[model samples]
Target: MDATKRPLRIPPQFATYAQKHELFELYRRLIARLLMEKPEDPLTFMLEELKREDDDVPAIVIQGPPASGKTTIGKMVSAKLRTAHITPQILLEDDVSPLAAKGRAIIDKNQSIPMELWVQLIQARLKLFDCIKKGWVMEGFPENREQGLALQQVGISPKHFVILDAPDTVLIERQMGKRVDPQTGDVYHTTFDYPSNSEVEKRLVEPPEGCTEAEMTQRLVLYHRHIDGLRRCYHKFTKVINADQPKADVFSQVITALSSKHRSLAPHIPRIVLLGPTGCGKSVQAALLANKYDVISVSSGQLVKEAIANESKTGEAIKPYVNRDMPVPDNLVLKLIEDRLSQIDCVTRGWVLRGFPRTREQAENLDTAGYEPNRVFYLDVPNDSVYERLTLRMTDPVTGIIYHTLYNPPHSNQIKERCQRHPEDSDDAVQKRLAAYNAYVEELSDYYQTGLHINADQDPHTVFEFVESMLVSQLPTNLDRD
Candidate 1:
C-alpha cells in the first residue's frame, strides 16, 4: 500500500487529542516537504522544518483606495500577528536612508513621488533588521504594477497580500464622514466607527481641505485603472476582503489570511475528488483546479464518451448500455475508472476526478483498487440552484463549453447562435436525477465524513477561491523555503 493510503490504527480519544493540537496537519506539512526536498537525512530535515516554522516571519502588504480601511485593518492585523506595522509615511520619515531622504525631498516640494523613488523607499524599510527579523505589515504602497515589479526585482516580496475593497458609493460616504486624531493619527468615521471616548471625540478633527470629495473620487478612478495589473502580479498570494462589512468581520478575514499557513504551490501529487449533484459545477471546478495546478482532469462521463469514440474494448462493452440510456454495471464502470487512474500521467503528475464514486460501494471499490483521493470536496448546492443551472445553461458544440443564460452568456453572437441545450436537461429528467442523488448522497457523505462541504450557490469565482484556499492550506507555506 502507498504510505499515504495506509489506514491509521489509533484509539478514538488519541485521534481526538491529535486533532486538537493539529498534529495531523503538521504531519501533512512534513510529508509535503519531504516529497519536495527528498533529503537523505529525513529526520534532520524534518527537525529543521519544525524549527523554521517557529522562526519564520510574516511580510504582509495591505492596499486599497482612500477610506477602504487599509490602514486600520493593516494595523489591527499587524498587532495581532505581532509584526511591525509600516506605512509610506513611516518609511518616508526615516531620513537616515538616502532613498527616504530623497522621497521626503520630493514630498517637501509638494510634488508626487515617482514610482521609482517610492519603490526604493519601501524596499529600504523592508530590508531593516526589525522588518527582517519580526516581519512587517505595509499599507498604501505599490499602487501600480511597475512599482510592484520593481520591488520584486529588488528581492522584496510580501508573504501575504490583501486588497480591501468596497463600492465607490460606500467609499465616498466613508470618506465624507472620516475623522482623525491629530496627536495619535488614529482614523475614525463619524457614522460607522466613531470614537467612544469623550476625550478622543473632543480631539477629533476632519482631514485637510485638499482631501476633498472630488479629489477622493479622482483617486478612486485612478485606483480602478491600476488595480488590474496589481491583482495579476500578486494573484497567487492575494486575498480580497469586502470592506463594506463591519470592521470586526473585515479584521477577522485579514487575520485569518495573515495567520493561516498556505503552500505557495502544490508540490505533492494531489488526488482531488469533487462531488456534487448534476449541474452543481463539479466538472467546471475540477477543470479549473486541473488547469491551475497542472493536474489531469478526469470525468467519468467524459472518459466513457472518449472510450466509445476510440472504439476500445471497454468502450465496446459499455456502448450498448450507454446507447440504450441504461446504467452500466458497477463492476465494469469501476474497472474502467481503475484502469484510467492507473495510467502513468495520473500516477505521476496527479489528477482531479469529477462525477465518480456516486455510491458508497463505488467509494469502497476505489479504495480497494488503491486509488484513494487525498482531498474530497462536496459542493453543497440546493435543488433549486441545480435546476436553474441545468435548465437555463447552454452548451457550445464546437468548443464543448457550457455557459449559463443569466450568469455566463456567450461573448459573441456567433457562439451564442450555435449553443444548444442537452436533451437530458429537461425538468423531468432533472427531477429524477436529483431524486436518485438524494437517495445515495447521504451514504456517500457518511462514508467520506472527512470531506469538506462547500456552499456552491455563490458566484463561481468565489466558490473557486474557497476551494483553492482549502487546497493550499493543506501544505506548509513556502516563505521559509524561498
Candidate 2:
C-alpha cells in the first residue's frame, strides 16, 4: 500500500489473524451468490437478514495507500452490493474548491482537510443511509483513529474493513511514474489515463518551488500514521488484501470481503416539502431546515427567475406581471411551480415552495399537478403590520443590501428620509396592493387545510423560535434539530 494515501487504518490485532485472506474470499463468494439468487431484488436478502436480527446497517471502510486504486475498488464493490458510495475527498473537493477560488483561507497550505468537514460528510452520508435500502461504502475517510472513533460514537461501526497493502518499492514506482501537469495540475500516468501524450509529457515536471523532497516525505509519513492508527482501532473488522496483484484479482478479493457483511434495511425516507408565502421567511426557514435535515434546499423562486430570464412560455406569460404592475396569471404561475418541482433535487431532497400558489386556482392546480406540501406555514402578520413592513422595505442600489425603515434601518437613514419627502404612491395604489396580498393569503389558508398559522407580529427572532418549535413537532424524527 502507498502510505501516502489517507484513509482508515487497519487494526493491529487483525495483523495476527491467520485466516484473513480465507475470510475475505468466503465473503466475496457469499455476496456473489446473494446477488445471483435475487438479482432483481438485491436488497431483499439483506433486508430479511436485518429484520430477523434487529441489526443496524453495516458500514464498510476501504483503506489503502495513495494510487493503490482504493476508489476504483470501493466503487465497484458498492455497485455490486447496490450500496451508496461516500467519498470524503470528493465531498471536500466539491465543497472547498470554490472557497479556495474565492481566496478564502479554508484549507491549509499543505491541503490538510478539516475535521468538521469530515463530520459533515459523515452526517450527510448518514442521512442518505436512511433513504437507501443498501448500506454505504466509505472511501478516503477516517484519516486517523480520532475520526474513526467519532464515527463509531454516532452509531457507525465497520462490519468489514479492507486494507490494501503493497511494498514500498512498488508504491515509489507508482508515485514516480505519476506525471502531473504543473500548469493545470492534471495528473497522468504512463497510459492514456489523462489527456494527450504530448500534453502529459509537457505537463510533467518537478514539484513546485516550496514542495521539497523532505516535505513530500513528511506527507507520506503522516498517511502511514493514520493507517497504523486505524489498524490499531478496528482490528476485529480489518482485512488485509495484497494490492500488488492484477486489478481484476484485487477487485475479486474486495467483492468477497463485502459480501459477508451485507444486511438489509427498509427505505422509509420521507419526502418532505416546506410551503409558505413570500416575505414570510420561507427561504431562510428552508435553509435552516436543510442544514438541520442534511437535505438540499430547492427554491421555486430561483427556478422561476431562471425560466423568466430564459424567456420560456411560462416566463413570457409572467413578464407583464413581473415587469409591469399587473398580477401574474394563475396558469403561468402554476406552470412555473410545476417546472420547479420536476427538478431532480426537488424529487430527492423535496422542496420548500416560496412565493407560489398564491391564488385558489394555482392552489387547486398544485393538487391537479400532484405537488403537495407535507407542511404549510401561514405567517399570520396583521394586515396593517404587513403594510408597514412592505412600505419600509428598501434596497441599496450599490451594495444590494435590504433595509427596513421601521425595524432594521440602515446606518445613514438617507433612503427612508428621501422616501418620506416623495410619499410616492397614491393611497389607492397601496390599498390595491394590500388587497391583492390579503386575497392571496385567504386562498392559501383554504388550499392547505392543515396549515400552521404563526403569529408574525412578534419580532423576527421570536417568530423564528415559534417556527422552529412547529417544525420540530411536524418534522420527521430522523431529521436533526437546528
Candidate 3:
C-alpha cells in the first residue's frame, strides 16, 4: 500500500499507555507548535523539540503595579526554589556584558532602555550557564506588551508568569508605608510587615529619592495600559495573585500557583457527562452537542431499551426488573454503558454520556473503567419548572418523539390526537424519581470536583448556546480560530 493511503492501526495497549503518560497531549502540543511556526527545517525542528526538556526549569516572572508585592514574592519564591533571582538592577549594574555598557550610557542620560536593547540584555543574561543550569526568577523586566513580545521573539519564555494585583487605593497606601533596608535591599511595609529585629528596624529608611509622586502615577498609568496585552500573551501559564491581603497570605498564594502543574495546550478528547433532573433537558442538550461535534451520544435508558427490543443476552438480564418498573442492577447498567463506550466510534471520535452514572458508586465505577469524563455539566432547573415540563409532556407513538402541550405542542391535529402519555411521565412517578435523585444528588456532586453547574431553567436553545460557549473556551489558546 502507498504510504499516504495506508490505514493507521494503533495497538489497544497504546490507549492505556497514552492515558497514563499523557503522550497524546504531548503530541497535540507538538503538532500545534509546528502549525503555528511553520518552520523551514521541519525534521530539525522536531528533533530539537524532542531533545529540549527545559519546560520544568523553574523560569518565573513576577509583575505588578508599584507596591503590589512583586519584589517580596519574587525573592521568597527564588529562595524557596533555590533559583537565581534576576532583577533589572542586577542587569543594569553588571560590569561584564557588552549590553550593560550600552544600557549604562542610556541610564546616565536618564533615558529608558529601548525595547530591542532590553530584550537583547535579558536574552543574553538568561542564556548564561549559571542561569540556564540553576534556572532563574525574573523581577521587573518586560514591563509592557511591546517589551514582552520582543523578549518572546528572542525565545525567552517563562514557565510561570505571575501577576500580583491590588486596587490602586491599597497600592497607594502600601507605598506610603513602604520601607527599605539599604544593606539587604529588602522591601517592607510598616503596617503589614515590619522588621522584627531592632537592628534591621533602626537602619530602615525610605525608598530612593527619584520615585516621586508624579513618577509613581506615570508608572501606574503605563502598567494599566499594557495589562490586558500582557494577559493575552502569557494567559496559558499565567496566574493572577491578589496582593491586598497580608504578606504571608500573598506569598502562600504565589507558592501555590507556582507549584501547580501547567495545563496542556492540547485539545482534549471530548469525554462529556451531563447530569440533571428528569425534565432539565439533559437529553436535548446531549443530542445537540453530539450533532454539532459528530460525537456519539450515549444514554443508559436508550441503550437498555434497544437491548430489550433486540432481546440480546444483556437486555434479557435487564428486562425482568424493567418490566416490574423496578430499578435494574447497577452492574448490568454499567456493563451496557461500558460496551457502548468501548466501540471504535466512541473511543476515537469521542462521546457525550447523558444521565448515566447517577450515583456515587456508579461514578466511581466509571472512573475505574478508565472512562472518566473530562467535561461534566450539572444542569440546574427549578422544581416548579421540572414538574410543569414533565407533567404536560406526551410522546408521539408513531415517531417516538416527545412534545409538551403548553411548551412544544404538535403542529398537526393527527399527531396531537395520537400522542400518548407514558406511565413514567405521570405526576406520582415523576415525584418518586425526583425524590430518588435528591437522595444521591449531593453525593454525585461532591464526587465530581471539577464538574460545572449551569442554570438550565431557560429555553432549550439558550441553554445549548451557553453550554457550547463553555466548550469553545477550553480550546487551546494558541490555536487559530476563524
Best-fitting candidate, measured by lDDT? 3
Question: Which residue window of length 10 is worst by lDDT in model 1?
Answer: 7-16
lDDT per residue as tens, model 3, 213-276: 6666777888899888987888888899899998789988887777776556534567899998
Q: Which stretches of candidate 2 lie over 4 Å from their true place?
A: 1-279, 290-302, 320-324, 413-430, 440-443, 474-482
On lDDT, who's better, 1 or 2? 1
Lowest-lDDT window of 10 residues in candidate 3?
473-482
Weakest 10 consecutive residues of candidate 2 by summed lDDT: 473-482
Q: Could you tell me the lDDT of residue 85 within candidate 2?
A: 77
Candidate 3 wrong stretches, greater than 4 Å = 1-45, 129-134, 235-237, 259-263, 271-295, 299-349, 352-482
**1 or 2: which has the higher TM-score?**
1
Best by TM-score: 3
Residue-wise lDDT of candidate 2 within 247-323, one digit each (tens)?
68998877666545433221212233444333455666667666766555665557667778999877777777778
TM-score of each: 0.50, 0.39, 0.59
Task: For each candidate in the order shown, give its overall lDDT on alpha carbons.
Answer: 0.82, 0.62, 0.83
Q: Please identify which of the two predictions, 1 or 3, would achieve the higher TM-score against the true structure.
A: 3
TM-score of model 2 (CA atoms) = 0.39
